[model samples]
Structure formats: structure tokens, C-alpha cells
Target: MYKLKTKETDNSVIEFIEQVEQPKKREDAYRLLDIFAETTGFEAAMWGPSIIGFGKYHYKYDSGHEGDAPLVGFSPRKAKISLYFATGDTEREHLLEKFGKHTTGKSCVYINKVADIDEEVLKELIKQSVLFLQERYPGK
Candidate 1:
């Protein structure tokens, strides 16, 4: 069985944000916290050591691999802030066109800081991610 390393924990999200070494990144993390929480209408929770996640859904793939994951989340890493959204969503790609200074990986959007991107777009991304997940993994 494969284990998921980013399982949600009962850790304090505020404490984790406070421990961020860079003052600017720490501040950006706080702002992201508010954005994700308000947009998702769900409280933030700690996922693993770094990720602050809001809302969750259970997912079981065709290969029988399954786990619960946040509907949306972010991590303020040393290099940049990683924004997590639903994978394979075309709407996400479209929204990113106007998201401003950011880079995308397979499942994350990396930004140097909060000011580098549009907050309204971020909120829309958050909303779409939650809706996508809820529809994909209905009742889970």
C-alpha cells in the first residue's frame, strides 16, 4: 500500500505560518490564509508540515488508490508559494491566463508572493477547485 505523506493533521495553522523564516513570505502566507478561508467558506487546517488546506474530499482512483485531500491549499516554501488546485481542470488553465506572475507545475501554481498575483482570480480558482472536486468525488 502506498502512503500519502500530506495527510491532514491537528497541527495549528497559525503556528506554522509564524514559523516561516522570511517575514515577507510569512505575511503572504497570512494573506493567502484569509483568501482561501473566505473563498472556500471552510476553516484552514494543517496538511503535513507545511500545507495549509481548506475543505476536503475523499478520492479513490481506478487503481484502488484512495485518500482524502484538501479541495484547495497552499504552502509557503523557501523558493516560492505553492498553490494547489484541481488537476485536469480546463477552467483552471483559463483562469490562470489572467492570474498574473505565476508558474504552474503538474498540480501547483508557484508564486513569489501574494502581490504577484490577482486575489480575485485566486478566489475564483479556489471556488472552481472545490466545485470540481465535489463533483468528481461526489458524496465522498
Candidate 2:
């Protein structure tokens, strides 16, 4: 059986943010924490070591790979701030069109800083991600 590496931990989100070497990144992380918490109406929790996540849902793929993951999250990495969102949400793509400066991975958006992106769009992405995941995973 395969186990997920990025499981949620009891680590303090504030402690993690404070450790970010870049002052701007650390400040942006705190801002993101506040924005995500306010937008999702859920308490922030540490997902793995770096990601500050809000809410969670369990997922089982057709291949039987199953795990619980944060509905929305972000990590202020050395290179960029990575924002996690539902992979196939069309609304996410639409919102990103107006989301200021950012890059995208399959399920993550990378931004240099919080000021590089539109905060309203970020909130919408977070909202859509939670809704999409909840609908996809249902009661889980």
C-alpha cells in the first residue's frame, strides 16, 4: 500500500511562516494566512511542513490511490509562493485570467509575492477549490 507523504501535521502555521528567510515572503505568508482563513471560514492548519491549509477532503482515485488533502492551501517556498487549488476546476482558469502575475502547474499556482496577484481572485480560487473538492469527494 502506498502512503501519502504530505499528510497534515500538528506543526504551527505561524511558526513556519516566521521561519521564512525572506521578510517579504514571510509577510506575504501571514497575509495569505489571514486571507485564506477569512475567505474559507476555516481555521488554518499545517499540511506537511510548508503548506498552510484550510479545510480538508478525502479522495480515492480510480487507481485506488486514496488520501486526505487540504481543500485549498499555499506554501511560501524559496522560489515562489505556491497556491493549491482543484486541478480541473474551469472557474479557476477563468479567474486566473484576471489574477495578476502568476504561473501555473497542474494544480498549483506560483506567484512571486502576494502583491503580484489579485487578492479578490485568490479568494475566489480558494472558494471554488473548496466547493469543487467537496462536490467531488462528497461526504468524505
* Winner by TM-score: 1
User: 29, model 2: CA deviation in Å?
Assistant: 0.2
Residues 28-106, candidate 2, lDDT per residue (tens digit)? Answer: 9999999999999999999888889899999999999999999999999999999999998789889999999999987
On a 0 to 100 scale, what is the lDDT of residue 44 in model 1? 98
Question: lDDT per residue, candidate 1, 17-76, as tens digits?
Answer: 999999999999999999999888999999999999998999999999999999999999
User: Quick one: best lDDT, which candidate?
Assistant: 1
What is the Cα-based TM-score of model 2?
Answer: 0.97
Q: How close is every model to the real structure, measured as TM-score?
A: 0.98, 0.97
| CA lDDT of each prediction against the hidden true structure | 0.94, 0.92
